[model samples]
Target chain A: MIRLVPRSDTPALLQVATPVMAVLATMIAGGILFAIMGYDPVAAIKTIFWDPLFGLAASYSRPQLLVKAAPLILIASGLAVGFRAGIWNIGAEGQYIIGAITGAAVALAAYPAPEMWIFPAMVIAGAAGGWAWGMIPALLRNWFGASEILVSLMLVYVAQRIAAWMAFGPMRNPEGFGMPGSRNLQQYPAASNPELIAGTGAHWGVVAAAAAVLATWFLMSRHIRGFHIRAAGTAPRAARFAGVRPETLVAFCLGLSGALAGMAGLFEVAGPAGQITDKVGVGYGFTAIIVAFLGRLHPVGILLAGLLLALTYIGGELAQLTMNLPAATVQVFQGMLLFFLLGFDLLTRYRIARRVTA
Target chain B: MIDPIALFLLLLSASTPILFAALGELVVERAGVLNLGVEGMMIMGALSGFATAHYSGNAFLGFAAAALAGALVALPFAILTQFLMSNQVASGLALTLFGLGLAALFGKPVEGVKAPTMAAGPLGLNWIVWLGLAMVPAIWWFLNRSRAGLILRGVGENHDAAHALGYDVRQVRLAAIAFGGAMAGVGGAFISIATVLQWTEGMTAGAGWIALAIVVFSNWTAPGVLAGAWLFGGVTVLQLRLQAAGVRVPVQLLSMAPYLATIIVLVAISARQKFSRRAGGAAPGSLGQDFHALR
Candidate 1:
């Protein structure tokens, strides 16, 4: 009989390999699912995993990957920082929506203009919008001792309503004859987040995401503040002794995450999504939680995990279209990846054993 | 002259799922475990319940199936965190994600299918609603009037002390977790069989999260869970009535009522907890902490 006990003292290599193993497990499981659906499993798997970057459709899908991965990496990196500090800010979706609304508000206010300052102003507004939204939970947890998780999650619904109000009320496109959305940012070149490189799908958001990863790496590795955040999470008593104020850390981490998520929302609205609408959230905020975890809450891990998640998302869509699967299949797949990664993560910390009864 | 009877009945049906989920989580936490995966378990229960009802055409069978499904999903959680000493918060989150993904995957085919109609057995009220009401007293009795309940509460209060007294802390917690999963499952079934009467993706829609908050807001009491659920149900029913009445409120704002109410309730409860040191003051000593027994 094969025992399922985890080995004692998992080595560093196993720490790194578990996520990889989980990914492999998901592929095998997903391939089986495809086969059960009567699609050619190999072809379906190849299309989802291989085609986006290497197959006949690489040229088109490759750019889309960067476009999709950019916001995820940016948001996930910010969230990973907070997660490391043991600060749970689950409302990034709310921050993302608020950012888009704020950023787009700036552009919409400046519509029909060709000013060079419009986009930069929108970026600042985006970050500020997210930061302000994030502060709600931070302040509540600080003052009222409310649960930040609930507060942040509740804010998502509030933000969604606010977004709907914007699309239907103030920001409604007058030219579209009463549609519930704002003017397409693409139409206003000044506000549009145009691809930095003509065909590479590189946008200002991608650049920001890259910068965020590098900056976070330095902060986490070399900065005193980063050390404080880590210490607070690992041992609150010790961190307090080291002069790390829990309240301040909570506010700072929550604010920083909100800003990044908000920036992601702003870039998405101005670049890919192209308008402020009710669907601006698209569950990215919640998905970023998974991205943060899959990335092991590390800056570098977040980068790779963000791309991997983005791949699954693109592949899930591909499988849906080509194999007659439902759109929700991707959500299920993403959820499974998080599930397996977390389950496998147990091996890193504890070993399982069975004892015989006397 | 007011039709208090109909208003009261409407409140009961709406509050059933919250009541079930809150009570279940209250039990889990009372045993010193904080399982944030209530939402995921509820969703799994909803899907499994719907699928079973669709196939078996029996609401009772569906509820039973949902309970089983919930317990099965929660078993790994019990094993991993309770036995292996994994981080409780992280493991609970994993259970939720896993349950959600598995539910979605399994629920794929059941999408768009209507649940079998749950009949009002002898009282003009859906049977599930009645069962939900009954569960309140049952949970109360279990916690205050039974030996197992004492052991469960004992384990939650201090696992080390309980273990020293020769009580099986891990066993008690494992049972509580399974029981919590079963209740969450029943709550999910209530959504399908009694509330929506249909299977839709993400239909639970933060109900489980609200239930978690309700556990906190209720200050870990059974009657408090019922009251909180009714408050939520009242908000939901009012919103639906306003929408039907064509009050011209933004539908988005109307839909956000329950979530907003949850935050308000959370604030009210947390404030009360902070201020009232003499009354209803203490929290479970071992709440959210893992219990490890070194052999």
Candidate 2:
């Protein structure tokens, strides 16, 4: 029997190679899973991974990559900042929903009026809405000593309900004869998040996501506040010794993440989603957590990881249409990625070894 | 009219899942390990139990399958966190995500298919509900009276001391984790078979998370878990009743009451714990920390 021996030091090569290895392992496992399901594993894999970028149907799917990746990257970027500081704010989904509703509230209030400031006002409302929602957990944790994870996650169900209420009641479009959705923002150019470029799917959300990447990279690497965040996560006692306030860091991280998630929600509503609906939040907030982990919680890495996940989303949809796979197959695939990443993450801290018992 | 009998029965049924999961987790925590993957394990159990029962038309077999499935899913978590020394928080999160995904995948085909309805016995309650009620006392006895339970608690309170006394800390922990997984599995099975009676994607709907919080809110006690579960169940049943009554509130908002109640309960309990420094006030000494033996 092989026994694992702990190593004293981790190598640089192993740090980079583990994620790559995990991906390969997942691919093999996925192929086997497909075979078991009586599907052509190789062709199915191609449809999911290869066809989205290089295959004949790449034209339509290519633009979708950006559309999907934009929100994921935006949300993940914010989540990563909080995660790095060990402030577990798991309710970005709730924030996202509230942001969409708040943002759309602004747009709907200004319907039929083509004003330049309407869209900008909607974006601000979305960000502020998310920030306010996030502050609830942060304040509770600070004041009453509540677990942010439980509080934040619980809020998600509440937010979903609120969104449902808005879509079915207050925000329901008057002219649409009682549908459970608001007026499409696409029809109102003033509040719409139209593409900056005509056909490439490059919209303001993508721009904001890119800007967030750069801004977070700078904040984490250069700013003193960032140092405090990192120090707090690595060692709370030491950070306290260095005059870092734990409660302040918790609020900041939670607030920043909430705002970023809200921005992603706003962009989505104003762009791809195009209206406030019962399904406005989707699962982007939850999926963004995976993206944050997959990116290893680094800003630059988050950008690349976001694109890769976006590719999977496009590919999953394409695979569903072309290969007759179920819609949830993508969720499973993404879940597999997280499992493999986590499983392989062990290599970073501990090395496996063979041992002999005397 | 308040129908106290119906209310009591609903509360009992709701508390079953929480009791099973909390008791299991209580065992695991007593072994000095905090497994946050309870949600994932429960979801796996839900899907597996539903699938097995749907296919075989045996609710008993379905519950057994769920327990086995939950234990199987938890094995890797034990290996990675215990042997490989991976971060417990990260591993737990991954487990939840993976479990949710895998359940959705496997449950896709099983969607809309009804499981074999659990027959109401002479008592007018399903067998699983009775079993859940029975488990409360059994769990209390196991944790408070059993030798294995004492050893488990000893390890949780102080692993190094337990190790010095020649107890296999790792082995004890593994057993506790497996036991926890099995109990959580039964809870999930209860949801699918006794409650929902149908397989739907993501049907557990944060019940696992609520159970996790209940364990904390209960201050890691069996009776407390039962009370918390009943409280949540009351909220859930009341919401359903309100919806049935066609109350002015939206159904969506009504459905959210339980989750909100959970958060409120968690916050209240946490505050009480902070203020009171009694024996049961503090969390377990070695919670969420991985043990590394230096020989």
Candidate 3:
């Protein structure tokens, strides 16, 4: 028999190492999974992990990593802040969709006019759209005491429907003979979020992502608001005694995450994705939850975790192209990463001991 | 005018999945374990049930396989939360993500495959629907009359008190979680084998989450779960019919009806509870809390 003894103080070092260990464990498990599916395990793992970064097609795949990581990093950074305050804003996907729709609406409304201020105005609209969408749950929770988790998640389905409606009815590109998507923003010069440097894939979204990282790090470490968030999560009664209003905290966290997710969506539409479509929500909001936890809810950790997840996306595609692996193989690998992370986290708080036999 | 019997039958079938999952979750919550991975377990069951039924040419066996598959998937969550004492919400979410991915991987080969045909039971309804309906009273009796049910509730209400009274809290919770998993699996199987009759990626969609909401909507009662599931089912069928009717509104907008209705119901329930000064009625005292045995 074995027993788990509670730790007086959680080992900080172990908490940090668990994510790294989780990644390695995921790779091994992914290898075994691939082998069971009748593929060469080592080759499959190498294709997913190594080939995207330094393999023969690295030049093509490396740029895609930044393109993918920007939105993930930006969205994850925003999500981590709320997560720290015990706010589960899992409806980032909805905010992202609304942002893309609102942003695209601005661009299309000003079609054929290359105005200097149009793009900036669109960005603001995108942020506001996401913010308002997120506020529904926040306001509901504050006023009616509803569960934010369920309300926010329900909004995702609603948002998906809204997006589909926009694509089919309002946002359809007139020039494309009634196809179901807005005008490709890439072709529009003033509104396009093009790569600043050739072949680097560094667009306006990448800049925003980097800025978000620095800003989040500073806010978490240096701001009094951050203190309130931590205090609320760790000790709610203490936070209340210290004058942290629960309603305000809930609104701010949910609204801030929504705005960031919206910006990410706007950037994605104007840059990589190129247009607002029916299927715009590709699970970034959902995946960012995993990224937030995988990063240990730290800004810098989120940045790195975003890159690691982005690597899997690139590698998963590469494996699909090189081998006959299913496209969802990456999703399974990501899911495994979270499981291992959660499982390994047990080590930080508890010590396993053998039961003495009498 | 719609045929009342046909509409009721559609509502029954539509609500059956949510009913099964919500009732299962009702028990889990009563036992003070919140398993958020119902979506994952449901999807896993859908694929496994469909695959087994397709291979064996037997729908009942397929459902059995689904139950086993769901319970098997939930074992890791039980171990992690019960023994290891990890964060319940995070572990449950991870379980969902993992279950979805694993189902996708395992289901890749069986995509679009037709399930074995199911035979009708009493009242011309599928056997699963009857099972779902019967479970309502059965669960009501289990929670209200049975000794084990009383012990489970005792454990959920206060693990410390239960422990002091010599009941195995961990064992009771683990059993509850496994039962929830099995029910969720059957719920998922009902979708693929009974309703859609074909496996697709992410087919359970957000039914699991809705079921979670239904537990709260029902105030954690077996009867309330039944009511919530039917209301949700009615909204779903209405939306589909509206979309089919093409009544000027966009199909997308019509599709949002069920989700929007769910939010509205939740808001109304919460608002009533707040205004009436009843702070958290019928909620399991230890729901969503981690339980660890200290020596």
Best by DockQ: 3
What fraction of the real A-B contacts shows up in model 2? 0.59
Write down the lDDT of every candidate, Cα atoms only: 0.85, 0.85, 0.90
Q: What TM-score would chain B of candidate 1 score versus the native chain B? A: 0.96
Error of 1 at B188 (Å): 1.7
Rank ordering of all candidates by DockQ, starting from the highest: 3, 2, 1
Tens digit of per-residue lDDT, candidate 2, span A71-186: 99999998999899988888999999999889988999988888789999999999999999999899988877888988998898889889988889898989888778999998
Q: State the lDDT of candidate 3 residue by residue for B1-295, as single tens digits.
A: 8888888889999999999999999999999998989999999999999999999999999999999999899998998889778788888888898899899888978887788878899778999999999999999999999999999999988888888899999999999999999999999999999999999999998999999999989988899999999999999988888877779888888878888888999999888777775677678898888877674
Which residue pairs come into collision in candidate 1? none
The most accurate candidate by lDDT is: 3
Query: Using Cα atoms with residue i matched to residue i, what is each candidate's TM-score against the true structure?
Result: 0.93, 0.96, 0.98
True contacts kept of 1: 0.43
For residues A1-358, what per-residue lDDT tens digits would candidate 1 score against the true structure?
Answer: 1224545567888778888987887778877877886778788778788878897767877888888889999998888888888888888999999999999999999887898999999999999999999998998888777888889988988899899888888889999799899999988899999899987899999999999999988988899989988999879999998888999999999999999999999999999999999889988887888888888888888899888888877877776776766666677677667666776786786555566455
- Candidate achieving higher lDDT, 2 or 3: 3
Pairs in steric clash, model 3: none
TM-score of 3: 0.98
lDDT of 2 by residue, B1-295 (tens): 8798977787778777767887788778767788878888898999999899989999999999999998888887898678777667767767777788788878877888888977786458778778877777787887789998788788888888888898998999899889889989989988888888887777778887888888888787777777887888888888888999999988888888998899889889888886776744656677778787764
- Docking quality of model 3: it rates as medium
